[model samples]
Target: MTRPPARPMRADAVRNYERILTAARAAFAEQGSQAPLDDIAQRAGVGNATLYRHFPTRQALLEAVHRDHIEALCRQAKELLAAPSPSEALMSWLKAVVAQGSTARGLAASLMAAIGTQEESWCRDAVFASASALLARAQQAGAVRPDVTVRQLLKLVNAIALATETEPDRDEQVGRLLDLLLDGLRATSTS
Candidate 1:
């Protein structure tokens, strides 16, 4: 059966929710996913009860903080779909995915560790949809090899992120690795 739409938050509840999210973002950024919940509540100027009311668990809070970045990536994909060069757009978005994975450090990893094929999954679905659209567009334009799957591309980019995670000059390393990856995936070559 379909669930009824939930009621809206009251003005103060809405303010508390926004404040909690902002505090959570800063806390997570400063101390990774293991940031103290009490500190977050204090930072939000709310009691622990209020923080719990808004976000029951660390995973939930992490997901909410990461949600904006995920939405940004999805939006970029939609815009890149209109770019003149489909192949370049795909590569550009892939680089962004790596950048997200790289810069977010433990934030995404903690959320991803709890992620599975759950019915209400938002993170995986949004990312897959974004990548799939760019991949399909590039493949259709014959700029990228039709043999490539979004799963494979995601794996490679993730590997690139992991490989360069500890490097002092990560931007250069990621860029170099991406160029090598793109060279291999070019339509002019057969795997």
Candidate 2:
């Protein structure tokens, strides 16, 4: 019997796998899901076979890219938790979230699809929990209205990201729009 085609990757394969993931993340962020897998392999300085061995399909690549961004977004939320004020923290996080959502074409769509689905529900929950904590802080401080929910903020950011999808200065526009939204969230004084 022919020796089984070189039993899956050996110990060193793990390092190459990680490097491919890192390179793919950067390439996908810059070129979207359509970015050539060959380019990713080249950037990782790995052979095409290695890239294929790790990620078998285009969907796998796309999902990995999505997962990476979500992980980064969650990390950002943790950092924002240390902000000086609730309102400032919430606003800054929202802006960063929007920018993150806008990094690649169709990313916002994929995130929305995954938000409540069983596929990535745990990740979604973690993200929501982070946002909820910030939102509650803002609300309790009277910096944000009591009625706003994390889901609503997510919808708003998704909408804003979608609206500015093709704009040249999309992030700036998203920031201005978010400022308007946050302004409306402030408690109005009834003098």
Candidate 3:
């Protein structure tokens, strides 16, 4: 059975929703996915009831936050279709994925766990489709090796995120790691 589409929120409800999301984002970034709901409510200047109405559970709030990021990643993948080179576009999206995974100190573990367990996760499906399309395009263009799987690529990206989570210069570390990864994925002379 299909669920009905969500109804539009009233003006104040919309504002509350946005505020909650913003607060949740900052809280999650600062305190991981386990950030207190009351803290989020306080940060958003909303009542605890309001926060609960918007997101009933920590997992629910985490999903909402992740959904927003996944949608952006999907949009980015589509936009990158017009990039000069297929390989470059794929690498760019991969970098974005790494950054997303590393956004919070402990987010990658939660995300990886959710991706593993959430069989009906729409956001995860969208992310996989977007990633697969980019990978396929690069492979078809002969810029990347055909042997690589999207799952493998994602694991590598997440691994990069985990490895650089504590670095003082994470962006630079992630960039260097991504470059090394992309080089390995390149179509080699023997492959």
Least accurate stretch of 10 residues (summed lDDT) in model 1? 110-119
In model 2, where is the ten-residue run with the lowest total lDDT? 1-10
> How well does each candidate superpose onto the true structure, as a TM-score?
0.74, 0.66, 0.75
Ranking 2 against 3 by lDDT, winner: 3
* RMSD to true structure for each model, in Å: 4.9, 6.9, 4.6
User: Comparing candidate 2 with candidate 3, which one achieves the higher TM-score?
Assistant: 3
After TM-score superposition, what is the CA distance of residue 119 in candidate 1 from its true location, in Å?
Answer: 4.3
The reply for model 3, stretches above 4 Å from the true place, is: 1-5, 8-19, 37-53, 100-111
Candidate 3 lDDT over 1-191, as tens digits, reads 11112877787887888788789888888887678899999999999999998877666677676665667789999999888799999999988888877764455654565556645666567777888999999999999999999878877887888788878999999999999999999997663
Model 3 RMSD in angstroms? 4.6
Order of quality (TM-score): 3, 1, 2
Off by over 4 Å in 1: 1-7, 36-39, 45-49, 101-119, 145-147, 162-166, 187-191
Output the lDDT of residue 93, model 3.
93
Task: Compare the candidates by TM-score and give the number of the best one.
Answer: 3
| lDDT ranking from best candidate downward | 3, 1, 2
